[model samples]
Target: MDGKTILPRSEVPEEFTWNLSDIFASDDKWNEELEALKAYPERMAAYAGKLGESAKTLLDWFTLSDEITVRVSKFVQYASCRSDQDVGNSFYQGMRSKAFSTAVALNSAGSFEASEIMAIPDETLARFYAEEPKLETYRRSIDKLRRRKAHILSPECEKILAAAGEISESPDRTFSMFHNADMRYPDVTDAKGEVHTLTDGTFVPMLMSADRTLRENAFKAYYKRAGEFRNTYASTLDAQFKQLKFFADARHYNSTLEASLDVTEVPVEVYTNLIDAVHGNLGKMYRYVELRKKILGVDELHMYDVYTPIVADADVEISFEEAKKTALEALAVLGKDYTDVLEEAFSNRWLDVYENTGKRGGAYCTGNGWPHPYVLLNHKDNLDSMFTLVHEMGHAMHTWHSCKYQPVNTAEYVIFVAEVASTCNEILLMRHLLGKTDDRKQRAYLINHFLDQFKGTLYRQTMFAEFELQMGKMAESGEALTADALSAKYLALNKLYFGDTMISDDEIALEWTRIPHFYYNYYVFQYATSFSAAVAIANRILREGESAVKDYKKFLSGGCSKEPVELLRDMGVDMRTPAPVNDALSLFGELIDELSALLG
Candidate 1:
């Protein structure tokens, strides 16, 4: 459905809408909290330079910081959720802007807290905790701050960096505006000779169409516009990489990759190992592509042919209610407590379901400790949307479990393990569905869907991850990142990954310009790693049952209390090794074999 044809927010059923009032009953209350948060910086200022005074003083600073953090979380969460509910809403846009400003001010005001704590000798900090038992509550947080001692600069320099934070984000902000609001794509005609406006939302679905003409037209037309604005995209991306390099250099890191991975203490080898493993398994992907060409009966499989399903009538239309039931049933393996949260999410209006005008195109789970996590989904009644519901609910349940178990300071999980929970849910759901069905076509469709996930999340994201690493290196080496250079690099990688089975069109080269994730520094690789980890965990749960579920639940509850690698290690998936990636690729190959037999 087109955005213009979508229902207005008010017209959406109340049952389908998220309960934003749970955060604040009215705008008046939200504004009241906003005004109250504006005074937090002054309150935080009073204890800034006095952190070394005594144990009680330090405890008081932490106490005030926690209070302000809770309030800040609520404000930002509410504003963002409200704004995202309808992006065109001016009032919520202003509110989101003000909340961001308050957050920056709060950060600037509290910038000295870290440096001051670092200045306190370790022996002194130990003595303070000994003297005041209450200080023990923040030991983990303090330890985290102390770990960054080497990177912490002088208070003045830190303040400058804090002040420049908003300015540094201008490129990404401009790209967001350009991609979401400003940039326009041309309309393309489908096989039926019906014209549809090609959008980022509709682009993939068009590619998934069985009609080669529709897929080719959509592919060409979308990139034709992207090709026109290549220079503009390249300029914005160049500025973003330059910003990444500036921070890496300022922090004395060897590269942007190091700087990004160090934040979560992930080793550089984890990233490199993923690329290496994928490279080692390139034959499997090439074979899969060759299988697609053979099954689709295409003489020459182009890039557009990659997404179309090989199984006929595989795009099953599943209603939202059916999706909810299937998600609940599929996740019951996680045990009753986990399924209870999913039930609450459905009955208590935790989701803003369905596509509506101005609603965000994709799906995500968001909220704060103050309220239950809220989910936004542009749900279509299809198998893809069913998996999306399960995927997002996995995130919501993770947030629910973490907030319920962990302290507010450590409630939020890092992005490294964020996809683990969601992808695990997807894997388990796929398995459950596959187990229950013996229908040949149904099995083929389900297996095909699973294969697509591996292809998209594991291989495709790793390709993007490699591209991101290369771009960083190029920018650091003082090479100009022009449109032609970026496209050529991207096209080459596409050739390497897709192999000779498919024709790598020039239009596919413009794929880099349209990917929003490249703007995210070294972020796409985790999707690949997390999918691998999830596969291992899902396999364990299927094999070992309750014991595996117990371990997985503990991992979810731990949140940021431990580093991501250590957490995954505790869950029995060692990302540092190539085992998980190779196992996932092996499973991909097995699925292809199953589909091949079924198709025959």
Candidate 2:
């Protein structure tokens, strides 16, 4: 297909794919930058022993690293997005594969450098900081460095870890490449008797269709196709688990989850406690599902009806341009700095919004620890897509701020805290919309939106967390994670969460086959934690004002300046306590009541 054949952001031609020119102005410029980036890692050999020298040496190195990080990050964003646009685009794919090597080399150097910094005598570091006033700004980053220093393996061991690095990530990368290449869906017939080809782009729209028949056919089409590759998915996922086990053993951690959290200093209990809290409130979720069944008036609610539109003829159709405006308005509370970046994102085209042949499904904002975060969305002009855009931009903004304000070593925050900024954007959008809308249907739509947040982030994610934890435990206890065992666990959890309201059949049982998070090694729980914290943060910002915004920006800019959980606590939301989780669940119940009232 010609590049011009790409789908527009909407039915209109006035829309365009995201603008990357804002970052580099042209591909020629990016090539020049890529060349320069590949050269910087080798330069690190000169700084071998210099990291522990003095505050001035460290500070100078940090500045140098930041500059290099920004440039390399830009190269990465450009290449990755291009590859995503067309997984078959060999030019960009080859370039990205090469870039991956550069990244691995750079990461090796980084791990080595940070490990070396940890070896410095405490007295020497203190003396250097005292002598260099500018270094005082980095107190938190330095403190975190000190904490991680204890976990720092010997330099030789660290080199071994780095050398075998990319192999550990092969499972994920291979799955992504294969799924993009081979995953296919059957054509779905809509209520009007028109047929639409079921690609990832059309799947969600079908699910959200007001026509139950369309949703049912769409779900059947999806799983029937996905089911063909079950054995392959299972094998790839198993390899991913083995990789996790390898790293956990290599790092001297008890398990993959513990090893992963050790990167951000989050306790494993944070995950366990989240699932437990959500489990305690599973009744609320079941009731929500029950309400869905009643509202849809389906005698037997199927998983296909899960995302079916409740309000017949609901008018939640938001255009891309309007969605951009809504995002700007919804995030208006983040102060001038936030709005400024957001404005730049929209106007300057920091996103590629159009879906083309081979374009990856889903949305995310990713940047190396430096440069502005680049976002990719398989653009669909709908309210949910609007939320998706703003949600990702939140991550981009947080990444931009963290990299700008923190040193190279601490610029990357833990994924645990990473979700706070994104989900806060989501909660903010909901609050903004709910405040402005009074129409019962719109309010109901907004209420549905909030409910889905709990469904996806709180309830659904907790279920995923359960699967993750059980698998990890099973992996620890010498149980094999075969396809049947995994599917049984997933289906049973579905039964638990859905209760008597909906059917939990074998088709939905294989739903685990499609989830990429299983490869993530205990990463799903953050969605719940982040939602809890976001509820607290978003509430404070709406109830308070500039104070909350100021606090949030501090949290964003702090990055890995300290332990992420501690930074969130300093900024007002405490993940360690269950208060936020309880508060969030209470809010979910309130939505359930509102929707119940409207439908009744």
- Best of the candidates, lDDT: 1
- Give the alpha-carbon lDDT of every model: 0.86, 0.78
TM-score of each: 0.96, 0.92
What is candidate 1's CA lDDT for residue 435?
95
The C-alpha stretches of model 1 lying farther than 4 A from their native spots are 1-5, 8-10
Worst 10 residues of 1 by lDDT: 1-10
Q: What lDDT tens digits, residue by residue, belong to model 1 across residues 432-515?
A: 999999999999888988998999999999999999999999989999889999999999999999999889998999999878
CA error at residue 355 for candidate 2, angstroms: 1.9
**Which residue ranges in model 2 land beyond 4 Å of their true spot?**
1-15, 25-29, 49-63, 131-139, 368-370
The digit string of per-residue lDDT tens for model 2 on 1-600 reads 111234532342323565656566777787787677777767776787778877888887777776766666777777787678777667878877776777777878766676777888888988988888877766666676667664568777887778677787788777877777567777789788888778766777678878877888888888777778777877787777777777788767888778878777898888878878888898898889889888878789899888766775765566678888888888888887789888877776677776776777778888453446778886667777888888888899889898888777678888898788899999999889889978888788778878988898989988988888777777777777777788788899999988987887568877877776777767888888998998889888988999888888889898787777889898788888788898899999989999988767
